[model samples]
Target: MTIVNLDHMSTNQLLPEVQKAMIEAVKKNYGNPSSQNAGGEETLGMIEKARASVAGLINCENKKEVVFTSGGTESINHGIKGVAFANTDRGKHIVTTNIEHNAVSKSIKRLSQLGYTVTSVSVNDKGMVDPADIAKAITDETILVSVMHSNNEIGTIQPIEEIAKITQEKKIILHSDAVDSVGVVPIDVQKLGVDLLSFASSTYYGPTGVGGLYVRRGVRIWPIMDGGIQEHNKRAGTENIFGIIGMGVAADLAGKNMDKRINHLKNISNFLVKELPNYIDEYHLNGDPAKGLPNLVSFAIKYIEGESIVLMLEDDGYRASTRSACATGSLRASHVLMSIGLDHADAQGTLVVTSGMENTKDDIIGFLRALKNIVKTLRDISPLYRKNQ
Candidate 1:
């Protein structure tokens, strides 16, 4: 049995080029980037080269705007908490959407515990947040508006550009958790007009445990980590040199191949959407397909639990996810699904399929075929399906 990874959202396969770069980095045994020596200077040069590549990937003019961190979670935490703490004099109110990842949701939740206030805007049935709704949520006390570039679970792309305009006019700092969208889609920080954007390397075939935060030149964000003045004084800690090198390579490749990758992913995504109805009944698609990420498809299958299907599919050599990997082990139905008006049963029945550059249309068909069998077996034993039937 050949195992195919359909859970690209959880993590992506490291590209060979990135792996090679990382291996070379480890072999060199480089010194600290901050030290004033030949070894340090050489290491610093490499870091800057990688930074330039990553900066080019996002179209950031100044490479100094990008700060390396542990991963997407750290980038998010740094961006949200840093901004909240630094701008306390201006205001303590923040705005966000209801369906954010745990990083954003919990970061703001922690702020709320610290006496800061938050207004979480709601999304429509298709999981897209309205820019007007975000505009209405801002107030004189609202210091920041944090929205995600695209949702990981449902793949609904938000209108960050429109929201940026609103925040700019109001002078509120706009931070977007772009972990799922940055490298997967065509992202231009200038075009998006966001003050801060958080992203992960694994989203684009880079090494895990590596990511970066893009802080617009003049953004007022404090350092989350207090120590050495690393990451342009935005983040502290010894850099993950090996992982950063891999991420830089991955970012460069992603920028060059984004168009080809998107077209391939769209072909697979379209195949999945077109073929799913033929194989199963009593199901609905989540997210706005026309406006969503081209690489992901979320399906809410009725009367069957998603985990059972995921496990059975894994046994049959296909790998997928029920929800965000970050939210794993939680028994509650997904807050994202609930935010989009899905009932508990439907929320528990969702299967998220995120494709990568390697996945093909045939892979989608094969997965759907296996899914048909699994859904049938599960539904046959489901009391809810029997009652409905």
Candidate 2:
């Protein structure tokens, strides 16, 4: 088979304008954004501007509410633990969904060990958490409700706006892990009604190893880490100057081109759904197709392991994944798929293909063809498939 390499989707392909911004950052490597020197003052100004840029992208009321972190995981930790610890006196109970990224899940677990009561609300077969369920689960002792805006594996977008409203009426804090939705989808912090939102730089074509948390003005959250008085004393660490600059550039680019990018992703997704199944049989789409990320498509093929199919697709030059990149190390089936009512075996066979600007119609067609051949070969060798046949 003549394979086209589609694996390793690069954000550079999505944001060519950021390259010059990154280069400029390298040339202006001044240390200690808080230093007394003029160079330091300039760096500090740049950092503040980046913060405002990020805050503006999310419709945050003020730049002071934005705190930069290393990435999504750190941002989630800050939101979960920071809120839980800061409001311990108010309550020891926290609510979140079962399908959250491990960053939020693990943070909840860590807080549980530290004597906090964590309540994990279940999602419907569409992988959406019912706002009523969240409202029902909330107790007077419930201090926070952490839900993801979208599922990374299956692309199921939760009702964060409704959830936020429910939390607010109850006078509880609502935090959303908006990493997947930040760039690919439109978000207004006020519209979403979330008190604290987490977003990653890489998801929006920014450089990796940098992310930010949006703490709505007047929301109290404790610092998860202690060190230099950076990020408005909310997060402590030397600023990632280059990465932050790249993030700002990326956010600006995304904001300007968001509508066009969304349309492109939607077109590619429609093409895949309409075409892929014609070539590949016995495949089931996962999650709510109507209410998911525009750029993400997840499906499960019977008699084929998801990871095996991903590897085969990679060999054919298609960059895809079996589940959330964070959950790649785990051998277990994806919790997201399971939450959506897929059986364990079906969930284990799930493959997620997320589109970026770099992906073309030819790319999707090539991936579909390769996937068809791979599934045929795998099914031919499988005893279960043979029996079914």
Candidate 3:
């Protein structure tokens, strides 16, 4: 039985190499990284090496600027909340887009509850946010601007570099949730000019429980967590030694093969774009195909449920997602699709297919065949389809 995995954005399978690294980290260097003993020093070296790998993948100039965290959610919280709490005197306003991942959106919502003002700029019909809107949203009281480098749901790549210039000109802080972009795209924090960036380890086939936030050198953001001196007192707790080691290896490996992986994703996704719409009538691609992430292809079918399609794919041993994994069990329609001007019915029929390193052409064809059949069967029975007919 050949099973095609299309849900890599939610999580990734741990690579064999990453597993080996994690084992070596625990077995050979299992000591508290904070300890002054020799084992601790060895453990510290391993962790730093991993940090360097993450730095290399993201083109971060200094490893110390990378602070380890639990995962993407935590990194975003630290970056947004850290700056919001630390810079209240500077300004109480923040700017972001309407289509941010739940992490950034929810974090800003919390900030608003704390009396910090928030302006959620809108995205155009193509699912792209304009730099002009971001600039317009900024004001004297605006202390920070956060944006996603690339959207996970629709694969729309935001203009972070341009937005960064706006923030830099005003001396305001810019934070990017690059959890979906760091391992997949060529990220150079220097070029992006972002003050803070967050990405999860699992995005690159590393362990699930670890990730990091890159706080550009000399950026003064308050610590969200406190108790220990870990993460240079920016975050405090015992580090996930094994997970860090695995993430470091994954980051290094991603840097080594990023071009190859990206090209593969594009090739496969292009195939999907050309053939997918042919099978289902009134189906539309969701994002800007040329500029979006190469790995993801999302679409909407008329008068159908996304969940039914996902379940049918799963029954055939393929995995797909209707929305972000974080939003599972919530019956609400995707906010992303709605923001891009999709009505509730159009958004309800949304289907997202995200490619990964392991998928083959045969897998793609098979998935498409199954999808066409399922959509036909579903629409054939749908009362709405009959009424429209």
Using lDDT as the measure, which candidate wins? 1
* Cα lDDT, all candidates: 0.93, 0.84, 0.91
Off by over 4 Å in 2: 1-14
Q: Write candidate 2's Cα lDDT for 1-389 as tens digits.
A: 55443332222243666778888878877667978899889999888888878887888888888899998889999998998888988989999888999999989999899999988999887787889999999998999999999888888888888888788888999999998889778989989999999988888888888999999878878998998788888988889998888898888888888999999988988888889768988889988666788888889888778888878777777768888778777989888888878888889898888887767898888888888899988899988788888
lDDT of 3 at 379: 95
What is every candidate's alpha-carbon RMSD to the true fold? Answer: 0.8, 1.8, 1.0
The clash tally of candidate 3 reads: 0
Q: Which stretches of candidate 1 lie over 4 Å from their true place?
A: none
CA error at residue 113 for candidate 2, angstroms = 0.8
| Model 2 error, position 271 (Å) | 0.5
Which pairs of residues collide in model 1?
A: none
lDDT at residue 297 of model 3 (Cα atoms):
89
TM-scores, one per candidate:
0.99, 0.96, 0.98
lDDT of 2 at 327: 77
The sequence of per-residue lDDT tens digits that candidate 3 reaches over residues 1-389 is 66689998888899999998888766784899999999888888888999999988888889898999999999999999999999888989999999999999999999899999999999998789999999999999999999899999899999999999999999999999999998998999999999999999999899998999999988879999988898878999989999999999999899999999999999989988887766668887898877899999889989889999999999988899988999888888999999999999889999999989899888888898898899988999999888888
True-structure lDDT of candidate 3: 0.91
Each prediction's total of clashing residue pairs, residues at least 3 apart in sequence or on different chains, is: 0, 7, 0
